[model samples]
Target: MSSERGETVAPDWPHPSLGNDLTPRVAAALAAAIDVPDFGTDVDATLAWAVATGADVATAPLAEAWQLLASTAFVDVGAARIIEPHLDALRILAEAQRDGVAADLSSLGADESSMWGVFAAEGSGMRLTARTSPGGWTISGTKPWCSLATSLTHALVTAWIDDDTRGLFAISLRGPDVVCHEGPWHARGLSQVVSAPIDLDGTRAVPVGGPGWYLSRRGFAEGGVSVAAAWWGAACALLVPLRHAARTERADQIALLHLGEVDAAMWSARASLMAAAEEFSHDGGDTLVASRVRTIVAHAAEQALRSSDHALGPAPLVGDAAHARRVADLGLYLRQHHGERDTARIGRDLVRGPASW
Candidate 1:
């Protein structure tokens, strides 16, 4: 999509990973595959690509996470968002491997498989009830916003075992009686992710952790920033077109100004991520810092969306399939951050005291 009189096209401006300890094979592969539209790939095939390319990152060394950030940024964000949760599911499964988990999740790359972290969500919650049974446990009730609910082979789900207590279960979605209802998501963006509802009609599951363990884990909040990273990646994807137009579309001087602002915002977001990574590496965990990272990155993402749309105009969204989905996908994905509530929470944390700070 071109705006200037003679400029009939917008050149490709891909994300750059300079000396970031990022994966080489993954980066090259995603760059080549980016020509594909956001919703073009099926969920099962997407998972296969992610597993084959090491997109389902684990939280051991921070470098692996950064590599994931870079690669997903290079790929379609809708796919990135879907692949990341599966990675998180695998990470959790790895943690719960020794605790009587029957399924061999290590076969992620070997088969047509994908996992989901089916935890809490907005509006109607997953009232899933888990009960001790002859084989292991059975979950009843429904889980909401279950992304790839129908397509995924397995999921690390949250289920209530008692009135006030909830537990985590490693369940196979292919099991009998599990019905994945048609998607409740009608959003213009991330429709490819297909967040739907699933009813576990006495589906058997392998127990992972007890009540409160999910949120209480050391990586609970830290893992959240990874979502923010993906958000930042999508936002940065918007920049490539903006940067291209600013450099090529010389008639529009204001476009350069927009690029400048977005560059600064992206810089700040990246710095915050690196700083959070360093903090997590050194201090083990910092929920407060991670929350701040989410707020800052989300704010930058929102700003990038607005600024890029304003600067580059709607031609990209209207004409370019990849650009349109990137914009929409990012717009929807950034909603994971709680907006003003996050900023207020950060402020409250700062105002509270330095004792915990």
Candidate 2:
């Protein structure tokens, strides 16, 4: 993709400064770590580093958002993804404490740094079920798309309370009743994430929020936007090869055109996310804004992937380590975002018009 190192030098656009206290150093550290090509291979050590520097467990849920951004930019989505729900669980725990739900949160963040994946998808199929008696609650069933299921210390899962309702629960992943089925996953990209369907046989569980309330939690939309930020990071990262390719004459004129277009898409995605961030601060957990930004960024990511693939052809896809990983990683991660369905959902929400918040 490059013209022999110094054939023509590109004026690389700086990765986002984010202009937040946590992001500057965290981004720098992440940028440095990306150079290693396999920095997140050790999930625990990487998490420890993230916690030591950027993640403040005490002020969490959203406090670590910027750090998540930094890590995502560096293609550490698997690690960052695992940490996301743990922080959310802590936030939910805080809410539970305020609501007088009597459960112990003392076990968290004490023994070891935890990587938690949230298993909250309520889609039909082999769904998880919860049963309660005088003894306590027990959960049993399957959860799909469980990222880092085997590696994470814990999970916040969603299960059926009845035919019409669902509830969120916090549970340890290592329990004897829990079975993490690793064989079913066959993803080429983000295989590092280790997503698998979990089968639980009466695993003891602690409810995180009341039935039907998990999706309405304050951080639900915000956490989604945070994930959008991560996907946007991978989207932004896909451009380095394109940028470098654009700098030289040997790079085909057609290739240069593709790079320019992809750059625009990246910029547009960033701009939309910045708008959503503003909305988040003012309105608080605006699902409308979250969906809007996620769709816009995912659109950009789709365009970038297509343009880059057409522009660069096959060499970088297989030969360039960083470029290859970024393409595959961003491609797969962005799938976590639903394109037209989300766009329509937002459109449906707009029946009252933009005049109403």
Candidate 3:
């Protein structure tokens, strides 16, 4: 990675933190663990290391947490994919606790070994609803995009509280009433992280927040930005082979040109992430800023992918497992940005009112 002064830095270089004391230690731990031979393949080991880091987004500086996430993604996109959701779930619960929402880890089936996920995607003609019963709250219906639902111990699901209102609930996926359906998930990227629909038959749930609270919270935007950080990290990882190709075997002007383009895109994206982290640390979450960061990073990631393909060709994709996985995982992950639809929405928002630059 290139600094603002045009000097090179290691991929695991620690970004400046907002007075967070744990930042350096966290960076060192991640840098040390990421080089392990088995860390990428063992999700449990990665998760355990992540949990041990004790980096809480709610308590620590948001930049610190985002940097941690980005560093994890830089080494292993699959590991980052697994770690991100679990951390997000913890943040959601923390927010719930801070808001005086009635929730307890034990009631949510969270334990020392519990793996958490968030399931909020709604499908057409399929509705998941939470209804009040004498026995407490129960959720029934099919929830789409429940990643790792079969293997996860618990999840935070968003379901319709009423006709037009949605609320967040924590439920145990291990219950007899909860069923993880087979098939439907066939993606090459992040192949280990299976995302499929889950069927629930009156599964017991504990509400984390009130109706509309899940989407309305500031943390929601912050969470979106966190995904962008992961995207940025994967983009950075793609440059590793590019840099190697540039160093080991010099090439013509065309390869150098593509390398420069990739570098410019990734450098700008990294700068954007750091700037966004500073803003989030102070001003909290602004939907517009978060959207802009995600959109900008998404564009940069796409550019990096394109330029890398043009420069290195098919050797890295076929010869290297980590490089190939990062390429595919990043391509798939960037789709969460919603492309032109989100871009148009941002443009319309800018046109409608006052903007923050």
Candidate 4:
């Protein structure tokens, strides 16, 4: 999912010197509107800002698109949590259209006003299935980890197309047959975005792609790395106070040491992503490229969390609402990486043979 472009459009808040562009303007607007602690409270307003800004992932260069996601996450992980999926859903839809796997976009009602969520996480004992009907397709059963299910207008859900394969389908969340179940999601971190289960009873849906196509597409891996880019931004958000503390005159040697190590890790992670973006821009998506970069960025984010705790102590975590929320948000968000499991996967890839490097 690489787009050739003439200029770079960096987001405004995190890096103003990157210059003025449509993405920067969107970033600036998001920065001003999103309140870190109270994020996800007003889904409509936040999504409205996004729709108004017209940030289409297909149009931007991969590097710039990732930068925008990272910058938004730097503001608030909750905002990133909302925006990233919307952007990913858009890209997924676009990929389906370009590959000629889906029908006209209008059939899915993919207009300017829609905010989408990607509901693909499967829970034990909960199986969502899709079947062909006279009225196109219908999805039934429950989908777990549907974040903001009640708030979002539409979602790209993955359901078992058959016993052997899963297919991606687009469904309107506001349908009468859809039921958003509350409770059971009581995590302190990222609590604002309630990821509850939703049950669909013969709800009509449009197939985005055939069985196995969603996971098989190149955009799947590339879209994953973009999520890691947001993770890196959230890590940067956590270290803001620590970086400031290390610069003060009374800064202790221990603070400086922690800051130095964390800074080095973050710098290396940033460089890795930049290099990955360059390669992806030229060669498109590769599983090895995505795996390597995600592992590096996830480790860097873990370092930020550990160093921020050790260097800053509990003061900010206890008193500063924004900082405390960022810490908690990042801590939970990093779990998406799968930690050592991801590392082991990368190791297996390396053991097989050398990558394109």
Candidate 5:
């Protein structure tokens, strides 16, 4: 819970959208309803509240509310809470599939849910496995980065077991053998994400499907779309404030024009991502389309962030405004889990055939 330098930064004003009074009240209500443990901070509590609330609300309303509350404080709270529930659901679905039980996953609102799974690296860092046992199997390895590790309840960890290499396991968060260490994540932006190293110390875990669970055609395709959605959400966080700053602040015509272009590109990127997500849900997941969506969204996000910085000038760097923190957070969050490299791979896959490594 302390910064790397042990420097105590001053407490920032509560996010404007959350309001001084209302945000706390909502957070309190959310804490009371959810079963979050005592280990997390206030931001963690708040994120749980926002996601739980947003998940049940209508899509437009949820997005509107998220826009209002999209601050470092709110995002920290929301991302922690949002990731776990979806991860738990995914575990159940994957387990059901493994056990030969058919499931109707459409009702879970696939488009809105976040993917909270973990994939391991072989030998040095990138190997997959799944060892079997009579009672239950055990998974041991390290995942490069788990974005919501601090708050995630379960993770789909990939590993190599026995002769099979590409294996998957649904590991519970509350298990004894699992050790989640907060890794060194010192970046200029997205300071709150806590995308750290997680050590699974021979943890007892339930197997999900079989070998090729993660890299298989279906899983890879769906995963691409899910990652695209997350990137799109981050893009919107930047766009909303850029639009406000452009309309209200005294900026040049060129700045306004650049803002317009960024907005258009972001919207187009979102549409493409959503279309791919819908396709995955409808056509049982398509890797080609998913890779294309991921590539487009990554480019769009980079463009949007750069344009926002250009339009807002030094405003984002000076004040402790929610917009400023969001920009910083997005910059860091986008880099998590081989973000740029993954984006490049997606592009390469689009040009070539199916994706590999």
Candidate 6:
């Protein structure tokens, strides 16, 4: 399903891809708010600040800020993209001490991500379902591998009703109708990521836009861009340490060249991302540009990780030091949400179309 604008429709949601205008003010605010971590605990605090500030800012700037914050905070912004629309709800539910509500929505978002998880069964997809009733539609289904399931206030769960009609429901995770089952699966790389399972039996859900919403929207492409932004930040973080090592000659000359190559890749990735961001904001949504950005960021991340390992040698793996932790975290973050899959998709797009596509 593609939009009139030629953007592919996300699996099951409405709204064009994540749209954003990157005003200078918003970008400056985001850059200023992203603080380098002094300790492990600081990562969470920085992430909280980014999420809180991201709501009011323009989408492009927020995306940029999120990338920067994730780099310093060592959180998986890729996973965050899957759950972000509901962050506002989570914040509200958390403020009200409505754990059930927060858990419910978070689960919904997680379910959506899981449907696209690296291990998703072939041909299986998730959707958000909604219908009109006196009260509202009744939503029921299972969402697997929901990342950050415990942090959302609502989820856009897709469902089918009667043949030929699909529905998207913005179901509250906290309400009585929703049920979430925490998972046993965990990853060492992105430990902070809360991917879990959620069950909605008879949750009352509201409609999002209208029927066939996912087929008409470009939100997922925008999400791809967001993920790209975060990966860029992680690459940037790796560059800083690599730069220091190069300057001090802590590593051999060959290692220095590797760092330089990684730095050049990072700059290239950033340039691609900025170009995509501009196109997304100005032309509505362009899957070609978004895919290119995704590919660039993923390659940059891989290069940065490899270079960091080369520059720091076994120190990052052996020591429990901050640098080692950051390096490990970057590895984990890069693996989130099938980064390889995204890169492949971008490659496919590049081969099939012109650079401007």
* Highest-scoring model, TM-score: 3
How does model 5 score by TM-score? 0.68
Q: Estimate each model's TM-score.
A: 0.84, 0.84, 0.89, 0.88, 0.68, 0.69
lDDT of 1 by residue, 1-357 (tens): 113201312245445442364465555546544443322245665666555554334534664565475456545676677767766766655555434443544433224344565555524655788899667678899888788777677777777778877777777777668898776679888776788888889887766666667666666666688788788777777777777777783637688888988989988988888887877777766788888889888988898999978987878778777777777778888877878987888778877867354
- The Cα RMSD of model 1 versus the native structure comes to 4.4
Write candidate 4's Cα lDDT for 90-174 as tens digits: 7788778788896454665667788888999999999999999677889999999898887888899999988989999998888
The clash numbers for all candidates, in the given order, read 0, 0, 0, 0, 16, 26
In candidate 2, what residue range of length 10 has the lowest lDDT sum? 1-10
Candidate 3 lDDT over residue span 1-357, tens digit each: 112111222444443222344466556766666454456456666666656553444356677777777766776677678778888888887777777885876875577567788898898977898999788999999988887776678889999989989999999998889999755778898777788899999999988888899998867888888898888877876666666667655677777787788878878887888888888767777888888989999999999899888888898688766667678888998888999998888888899888988
Assess candidate 2 and give its TM-score to the true structure: 0.84
- Evaluate all candidate structures by whole-model CA lDDT and list the values in order: 0.68, 0.67, 0.77, 0.77, 0.52, 0.51
- Local accuracy of candidate 2 as per-residue lDDT tens digits, 144-167: 878777777677889898998898
Give each prediction's root-mean-square deviation over alpha carbons: 4.4, 4.2, 4.5, 6.0, 8.6, 11.3
Instruction: Report the lDDT of model 1 for residue 152.
Output: 72
TM-score of model 6 vs. true structure: 0.69
**Candidate 2 — which pairs collide?**
none
Model 5 residue 94 lDDT score: 51
